[model samples]
Target: MTTELRNTEFHIRARDGAGAEEHGPYELDIDPGRTADGDAAPRYASLRHASLRILRLPPGGSHTFATGDSEWIVLPLNGGCTVAVGGDSDTPFELSGRKDVFSGVTDFAYVPRDAEVRISSAAGGRFALTGARCSRRLPARHGPASGVPVELRGTGNCSRQVNNFGAAGVFACDKLIAVEVLTPGGNWSSYPPHKHDECRPGEESELEEIYYFEIAPAHGSAGLGYQRVTPSGASSRTGRGTDVLAEVRSGDAVLIPDGWHGPSIAAPGHTMYYLNVMAGPGEERAWLICDHPDHGWIRDTWPDQPVDPRLPLYEAPDADLRPSLNETVEAGPRPSLYEAPDADPRRSPNEAVEASPRPPLHDAPDARPEAHPEDPEGDAR
Candidate 1:
């Protein structure tokens, strides 16, 4: 990889069929008050190297989850949860939710392959939980799952999560990490210069990253954001130094190959929400972002700012981050190149519900590909 490609970069948003091969700029909305075992089966996918299955649970529901041979991270996007990593263990980890908190659930609980887990949601709301394996592909190392006799819901794993990734299991390259970074309403993240290459002194772990944002739902007309990424002076892709100041809404995405990034510029009228996923071939999972050397130590001279009180972990996660009405933004629009029209399980399969040969969340931008225009066989959700 070139020096510039080591810092930050973006992949084209996942088109309809794009998710089948890769994951980027994708969105799946959940129906409120729905549970996993509901009428339609919740979605599940074992990507080339990882398996991520999500289910919505109603209040007072219990489910068993297995991590077979993979390390997993279980997060309840909404609602309060009781999770026991190694079920049957005497001590279980508990997370409470505030009335104003997201769907009322605490953040994710890291679960390693060393244990089996069970979860319960007390408050009724939609819950999105994903389980992905670790390490590169090898054999069928199935983690424990939502096993039998649990309830009227299907005890068996779905047909979709049963494909063989063969040589592409979890470890192909580092996959994901959960970071609780505090970027006050109007601050930035990767400022002051830093990089994560060369396992020497400061910069350990050499991994690629993905930034997923979750803004305060209530930032009505003013909640806008943007990112700036470009090549550093010493290493430019071309003789010219080009930089991009890309503005973003809730679901937009940007690519970063090099340069200094920051000042997530949350427009004057609102705050912002964002999550970043990083994975690469390095052993260390810790983060060490390098800034423009000239501006590197700016962090030492910066003052800490307080966060907005009305965001997630505080109040209810607003339904959808609607489009801004009549506001002007400094950054340009960053729309996804593709979209998954039938993302919700509650919706009946329309023309956009076919299967693909690529990974689960990375495919084309239109409808799911069909076998042939002349054939219309088994096409269930």
Candidate 2:
């Protein structure tokens, strides 16, 4: 690693895939010009747990790997592909990838630990190889895009879309946990500043996360956004604290080792998408977090507001893209809208729910409504 690469912390800026300088063990761009052999050596390969790789292949191009101790998911960022495992012995599965992250949810294939696999695209594609060191050798399987749950979170400007494709409760994985978040132009996601860096048994889990971003711009223009991670005032057992504030562009990545990270903002006129890959030393693959007390009040204000109108960007086939009656009903005179646990510090974490009793039809105008009861922020991390 060059001196410059070594000095930069947390946020990993994009680099020419073919650059001669070695990228430190935190970022890698799999461009054809740079790594003609195959996927570049993962920058985080030496980190005891999580690893990520971006793969780009031309039509007819293929990449193969031996899964050693890490299980991986083949998530297409763009285009379709085929996943073949165990050579002729096992059947190969196909994934119908979307045109882009913003296009819609895409099917993904999971490759088990200690296996041999090959991934190839028919027309050409880019993929995110999200991997984590694990002990269980789970079966390789394909997840359909239609099955991925699409969640609309926050209200108005804080609203965003979350595709819970690989959430802990949604999909079974040994240690790898991954999800995608889409913030419309001028919106904010990952609000209330939360952290999962401590292993507090039933309270929180210690997890390291990577935020890989992609910004969508208007036609003939560029896109930009910002991300912030403030110190949570609690240091890791190693006595290190993470702090980062970055201007992120497409392909940029941010590493969250410890902190209250949030308020990922999409600049006006440009939508932002980010793939979150996480894992930790804990035995249970849970994504528990603690909201920053200072900003936790933001959740209470959501029930009084309406969700952004441009949600569910691309519904699965046979799904309705139109706004549901539930959303409209929640925005009305009823008080059923605010029931999120984070909205009230008095509410126990275990009290969070998907649906709760509808509040009285009428309440005082000063009533402080809680966030949506559906828990849109639950699996987003």
Tell me the TM-score of model 2. 0.77
Locate the minimum summed-lDDT window of 10 residues in model 2: 359-368
Clashing pairs in 2: 18-34, 25-43
lDDT of 1 by residue, 144-246 (tens): 1110000000011111111101101111212444322223355454443344423443433343333444444453453556666555553254342335556
lDDT of each: 0.35, 0.70
Off by over 4 Å in 1: 1-70, 84-94, 98-108, 114-122, 126-177, 217-219, 231-246, 251-260, 303-381
Measured by TM-score, the strongest candidate is 2
Residue range 67-125, candidate 2, lDDT tens digits: 77788988999999999888434438788898999887888888888888888888988
RMSD of each: 22.4, 10.3
> For every model shown, what is its TM-score relative to the native structure?
0.46, 0.77
